[model samples]
Target: MTQFIVSLAVFLALHSIPAIPAIRQRFIRVLGRRPYLVLYSLASLAALAWVFHAAFQLDYVELWPPSAWQAWFPLTLSPVAFFLLISGLFSANPVSVTFRRGDMKPGAVVSITRHPVLWGFLLWAAGHIVANGDLRSLMLFGCFALFALFGMVMAERRNWSNPLNASTSIIPFAAIAQGRARFGIDPAMILALALTVALSAWLLLGGHAALFGTDPLAMTST
Candidate 1:
């Protein structure tokens, strides 16, 4: 537990550095943009590796026994979660802290929510924590949920000039309805959606069992 807590702290601290503009700017100036990015990625990966190691080695303590109905939660929500994950990857919104300028218009998925990746992580974490209902699972997934939510808040604070800033709500389509943003559909978004659906199918079939030693479909049957 101590090691796990330390790993989580290290990971969060490393991630939070980029949220501090002055420190980030100084680091970028000193290290140069490319080198700074490489160093940051490496450090974050190392911290994540530590977190994974600690999590896998930790003994489980049952916090709440898994409810039969809880098993259906991930099965139902994972498609939306994975869609958000993939769509966010393809979105070109400048407001997103993870924004990568792409050919696609910064709408559609961006119109749904500017922070799709974080929202994806938040959903994934919430679903798993509810299904697993154990101390170790709670600690692992709960940390991710908190991290995702915090990252969204920090990113919004850092990019106050975001076009959608006029609307304070993070709910899907809220900005669009308020005329703060608009939706556009294109080939890239189509590709992202198709891929998300395929990936979701693969996970639901046998991938979940192969990776996590449990079949979501079988769980649903019980």
Candidate 2:
């Protein structure tokens, strides 16, 4: 629990960097853009690993007994969540979360939501909270849900004045529906879907149990 809190704090702090442009620019100016981005990305991954490590150390105190539907909910949502996660990370997405510079275009996923990564994270967190139904899981996933919500709001508010945002929106597909944004496939979207499918298959076929000590398929069966 102590470790979980500490790691959560570090994760929150690290993520907050992107929410603050001044701080991010300062670090970029000092480290150089590409190096700063690379280092930050690595640190973000390390912080996430620490969060999972610490969370597994927590005592399981059930808030509600697990149910088949509960477990299945997250499993069902996992593909879409991961697809958004991968596609958003891969796209240039000048309007939202992006890991690298590209052709200055928001990809197909971004046309759905400028904040696809955050929406993916939100779905992941909310689904897991329902699936696990435990204090530890709540703490772990709840923070993530809140973070994703906060990120979406912050990103929208911060970028609201930018002309690029005129073509995008916070709600999924709203921009495209309004004809503000156009939808088109991205190479990254294809790769992301392929990777998500492989990942989902592995998780369903006992890999999740191998890593996390529980099987969603088994959970749904019981």
Candidate 3:
């Protein structure tokens, strides 16, 4: 429990650095944008892996009996989640966080939401929370969902006057419904869909259980 708490704290503290523009820019200047992003990704992954490991070390306390729908829910949601994740990673989103800062256009994904990446994380955590349905998992994935949501709020405030925000929104589909942003199958969408399919296949087949103990596609959830 102590290890879990400490790991989560460290994860939060590490993410906090990029929330501030000045600090983020300083690191970018020192390490260069690409290197900074690479380093940040590796560090964040390590922290997240530690969080999961520590959580697993703690005792499991069931919060609810699992059901087939809970298992199916996340599987059905996998495509959309991965779509947002992949598309967001490739977009040059001026109004929110993104990995690629060059070449990639603010196309279809940004049309859905300026914070697609955050939304992806939000869904991923939410799915895991439902799938696990335990005290420790609730704490772990609940915090992750909250973190992604809070990041959206921060991004909104951070780029309040950003020109792109005129057409983009934090809530998915809001911009498109409001006629603020356009939706279509751009290159990013094509790539996102293709990769999403591939990933979903691998995970459903055996990749998920291979990495994590639980097989998500197992017929019995309870």
List all candidate RMSDs to the true structure: 3.8, 2.2, 2.2
lDDT of 2 at 160: 79
Each prediction's total of clashing residue pairs, residues at least 3 apart in sequence or on different chains, is: 0, 0, 0
Candidate 2 residue 184 C-alpha distance from true site, Å: 1.4
The true-versus-predicted C-alpha distance at residue 128 of model 2, in Å, is 0.3
Ranking by TM-score: 3, 2, 1
> Can you write out model 1's per-residue Cα lDDT over 1-222, one digit (the tens) per residue?
899999999988886765455667688779886788789878978998798779878997998866679987777767777777767755665666332443345646777777777788788889988888888889988998998898888787878786556643477678778887767676557877898788878877888777667888777666
After superposition, the stretches of candidate 3 with alpha carbons farther than 4 Å from their true spots are: 17-19, 102-105, 219-222
* The best candidate in terms of lDDT: 2
TM-score of each: 0.76, 0.89, 0.90
Q: Return the number of clashes found in candidate 3.
A: 0
The superposed Cα distance between candidate 2 and the true structure at residue 220, in angstroms, equals 1.2
Model 1 weakest lDDT span, ten residues long: 96-105
Instruction: Give the alpha carbon lDDT tens digit for every residue of 151-208 in model 3.
Output: 9999888888878888887889998999988887777778988999999999888998
lDDT of each: 0.75, 0.85, 0.83
Cα lDDT for residue 37, model 1? 74
